[model samples]
Target: MRNLIFLFFIVLAISVTSCRKDFSTIPSFGQLEFSRDTVYLDTVFTNIGSATYNLKVYNRSNKDITIPTIGLERGNSSNYRLNVDGIPGKTFDNIDILARDSIFIFVETTVDVTSVPDPLYTDRILFDNGTNQQDVDLVTLVQDATFIFPGRDPISMEIDQLTLDGEPTAIQGRFLEDSELIFTNARPYVVYGYAAVPANKTLVIDAGARIHFHDNSGLIIDRDASLKVNGTLNEKVVFEGDRLEHVFSNVPGQWGTIWMREGSKENEIHHAEIKNAIIGVLVDATTSSTPTLTLKNTQVYNHSNFGILGRGTSILGENVVVGSAGEASFAGTVGGSYDFTHSTFANYWNNGIRALPAVLVNNFFTFTNDQGQEVIEPRDLTQANFINCIIDGNNNVEFIPDRVDGATFNFNVSNSMIKFNDINGSFTGVAELDFTDTNLYQNITLNGFADFRNTSANDFIIGQASDAIGLGDPTAAAQVPMDILGVIRTLNPDLGAYQHISF
Candidate 1:
């Protein structure tokens, strides 16, 4: 009985010690360490939530410390929200930190455009009381956008989807109405899903219009519909993902392509920039008999796939610049007709191993037949001409001219800088890419440097030291009198989309 009572007393003592509270804490003396002195919330649209960011708070002292108050400087009026440890609130009281321990503080924001007094909304996370206070700065840029999203069904609650063949598709999108057919520079347009142009309708974008797409969102032109971008030299139309943050500025594949279906005729884009997409421009089934699209003084950059994909389509390009694609910068596949004058097609992608060349023109496509056997289908390549252009990349062979037996393949490259190194004898038996054939290749500078001005900065301007200076065909220069930057090309013109800069 005595031993049992002793064991019971010992167990009771252990339980009491464990249940005892340790409320003793020294006030924080402004010695709190932070993971970052300034937390940038990136950029967010008006009334849209920002990506969640985190910051760590450390207590270096050996003794436990109590923060008198942890809150935003603006208190309840601030647009920011803080989650201290696990609890979320605008302000917290008596937050304690164990000895030499740290806690994570998550930050998020959603601000209204009208509520923000300036472009940048700022606040501070304050710690402790008057004399023993420490603070971490917070900053975020807020932009106003005209948002367009699909509506949900009233009864079925099904999200709106793109229509194809009289049935809804998995693509979350809706067709544009008559009133929304025109876009202006009044505000930046933010598209949530695919904004499809209805059949036989035209979508017009005015100069200086900025169109931003969300993830997997893009613009699509339906059959018999057209797209017209009326941009000018001073005011260019911009198409990109809606991240708006500095980190995502040059990132690729944030959105989908600008796809133009067959029968979408008379499409034009001039002095515009299209970037950060899976494919900058995708032309499907637009045959080479007539001009499918006209691209002039435009820039396409940082695409995950081809910069300009032409599937049996015809395109007339002048002073067009394409840059940095995972696949070919410009791909004219399935036997398309392409004419590019005073243009630049360069791929300096450092992302991964690229199997495709910078520029490719093929006269055939392959598919599996009913017997599950691969079959080649040939299409006639009417014309693929590159005059006074620059087709160069990091690869040894930057241009590929593919030809199949059933189709007629015609191509000409005159007074251009190209990169074609067949050191491995890859084309020993292929007659399609014969460099000695003067009829197909004329005045070509084989494996020569164009000497671009800082390709890493996406600056394709030709430097004075470049050998391509004064190497352009005079007739082609006369056709495209002005360069992409509105500089008049002299009779002794330079190759590529941009003219030679003295610097």
Candidate 2:
């Protein structure tokens, strides 16, 4: 009787184990819920990979269900790809989800225009099989682009790099060829690395040309080289990052700057929009008496650093607007000659705490020497003038004049609106900060009302009630007769870049 009882207990344990293994999942019956009915992957340059997006597959029913087949409508040849259960493929089978739970389906795409056969690349992610099938639509816009990248060595796998000061550097770049001097508007140019202009050569960008740069990519004009951007009022040139997604449109520091390096001469940019860069335009130090950079009717916004940073260079600007920078909107450091008329330098930086002013003018800089000693270099600021310009921001001080006393710092800000509250008395006893001086600062409306239409949206048009509507100097307005947007400025023009307009 004891042996029989032990055998019965063993059989009971086996039966319980078999019953657990017999549990089953129900087949999906067109009841799967999805996060969205369609996924718009956004526009992208051809042959460029898009940002990854996810779709949540929820099983709201009480029973655990198994999707028999999850496949793309185009089968294995589709441009779209899927990742399920740590495996990547175009088709998956037996995808199971628990009751009242959800599983994510990640999607990505890299398509070529030539192979897509159509401008709109469409695909569908089909779940299950036969009558119980459910699908999510996938759509993307593919754009053809003229790709520019540095050449690589086949054997060593080494990419061409820029050499600085007779030493090899990690900056991946190559000088542009002779045939690539002119950039037209036929197709957008997508640059993967720094495209350097050869010495003594000139690169011309025609109107309506769009230049998109990847991370760290920029345009560098070498010694004696020049760059001319001829954009019209209606068809303006655009320089921005390669990301065409909506969320990345206004994000700053996506790429580098359009650097007119040291010794580069006669750089001119007109009617261009430069955004989402470390620096919109960088005019390095030059000994030439003429203007290093001529910027006219240009708008530079959403820059991580200065919109236009001039270092010991001469800049002549008219009808220019720079808005919202992490640092200054326009920073003339190390003693540069700047002459701006009918321009606006506004900084309503909302990203984080910004201690610097919107417009910064400093004549001195410090650096460490070879012998470990810190040395101070003060250059003469021959001219730092802003006529009929508005330099304002959310900070108490939007304009700072930093002089080291060892150099000649001369700035005449006449007929302009400025924001200098001096909340902490930091500029107390500073000769340059004295706003009462007629020679340095004249006819300035300090902290007066300059009602911008919408600073958050970057629309800097002044309204009728704004104090700057008729505060401009007539002589200065004549230099920049039209506003940045091609509107004719009145005889008594506004102080900022734009004339008074109805909101």
Candidate 3:
């Protein structure tokens, strides 16, 4: 009887283990997926302004998912509304999605903004699909609704009660006893004509400050004075025009300019966005050598002439994007030197960058137009070293060296990528020591004199197992210390900005 009881217990244990294994093979309900990671707003608006965006819903499980309703709500407020057609924050219902299928839900909202009171603000929109919800934030700011009158010094305007739709708004301004001025507002304002910075005085601008310009209006810093514009990433300080639309309108010389006059030093500008101007940042000849002009994470876009014109010396940090409308993007004339790293030069009608014979440019990416047959012409560039840079252009657009009447231009490029659709007519003037990797598709058509003694076509490194692989000058600067990307510097660096170590 005891043996029979023990055998019965062993069979029961085995049965229990078998049942647990069968239940583990079963699948769960479903998973949710979204369309985008983040949304960005390019301009600021007020009062019944609306923008539309779409959210894609994906069903990842085998079972069907039912979206009963879709709506939006403010994260801070209990007020929730359905996102529907024609109405802001209107919701749609009865949307059935099959397994491995997706659908798009549109979201639109009208925000009430006022210019007489505070100018800039931000808010978040919470998107809920019955069971799950996601949040997206939006930013808005008031714009200057007025134009400037040209030909005026110290342009002045009266501060009466500025109202927004008959509402008492917050308007603040203060003039110090020593002729120093301070202006603060929640709404947008404009500056007309040429505004001059007084001598021996400092101008301090807070973050999220938006200053607009009337036609031909800009700021000029005279000798013995300084301007400090300190802004944050989220709350960046912008200097632009007073236009309703933020599109490029070819408004040449219509915005303000910042001129650092002679004898002026120690001017610092950080985290600023300067746009829609004629000349963005002008460092005059009188700028003292001790006070280096520093620009960090700054963007100068949609300008007419040079983006950042420096007649003196300057130091630009990483991640600088400069774009032009129809002319040269950057021109450094008169004894200018630039130490730029991880910067971009894009979208210009004329030359992308032109450094006078006295200037030096290092570690930059330059993009020129293919339609325009114009080449970047600098005068007397002494030592222009391109390290891990990218020069992109079309076949028609050629790379023309600076025209030195008597002196020679010394251009040394290492671990770089210079691409042109038409290599036949690309690059003019003879180079002293041209270390080019022959990975260019039209390398046979390239026209120029190069020091081929220390270079080899086998040294040109290609992206992959292409014919131009292993062709470049082994003695290039990028090969010595390696580049920002970790690839062993070879005797021949790759043809473009990036070097491929392994497949």
- The CA lDDT at 318 in model 2 is 92
Error in Å for residue 327 of model 1: 1.0
Ranking under TM-score, best-scoring first? 2, 1, 3
Residues 1-503 of candidate 1 have per-residue lDDT tens digits of 99999999999999999777666888888899999999999989997778789999999999898898999999999999999988999899988898899989999999998976797999999998788899999999898988878652223223788886687789888889999999999989998888999998999999999999989899999888999999999999999999877778999999999999877888999999999999999987774366789999999999999899999888999999999899999999898789999999989988999999999999998899999999999998889999999998888889999888999899999999998888898878777677778899888888877889878766789888887889998888998999999999966889999999976
Candidate 2 regions off by >4 Å? 1-24, 85-87, 152-158, 164-167
Model 3 scores a TM of 0.46
Sort order, lDDT high to low: 1, 2, 3
RMSD score of candidate 3 (Å): 20.1
Error of 3 at 427 (Å): 4.3
TM-score of each: 0.89, 0.92, 0.46
Q: Candidate 3: lDDT of 383?
A: 39
For model 2, which pairs clash? none
lDDT by residue (1-503, candidate 2, tens digit) is 99999999999999989656344688898999999999999998998889888899999999988889998999999999998756789999887888898898889999999996897999999998788889999999999988778662223223789875467779787788999999999999998778889888999999999999999989999889999999999989999999998889989999999999889999999999999999988889888999989999899988898788989899999988899988999999999799999998989988888888999998987799999999989998889999998988889999999888789898999999999999888889988988999979989999988889988766688888888988888877887888988888867788888998888
Question: Top lDDT: which candidate number?
Answer: 1
Hey, what RMSD does candidate 1 come out at?
A: 4.9
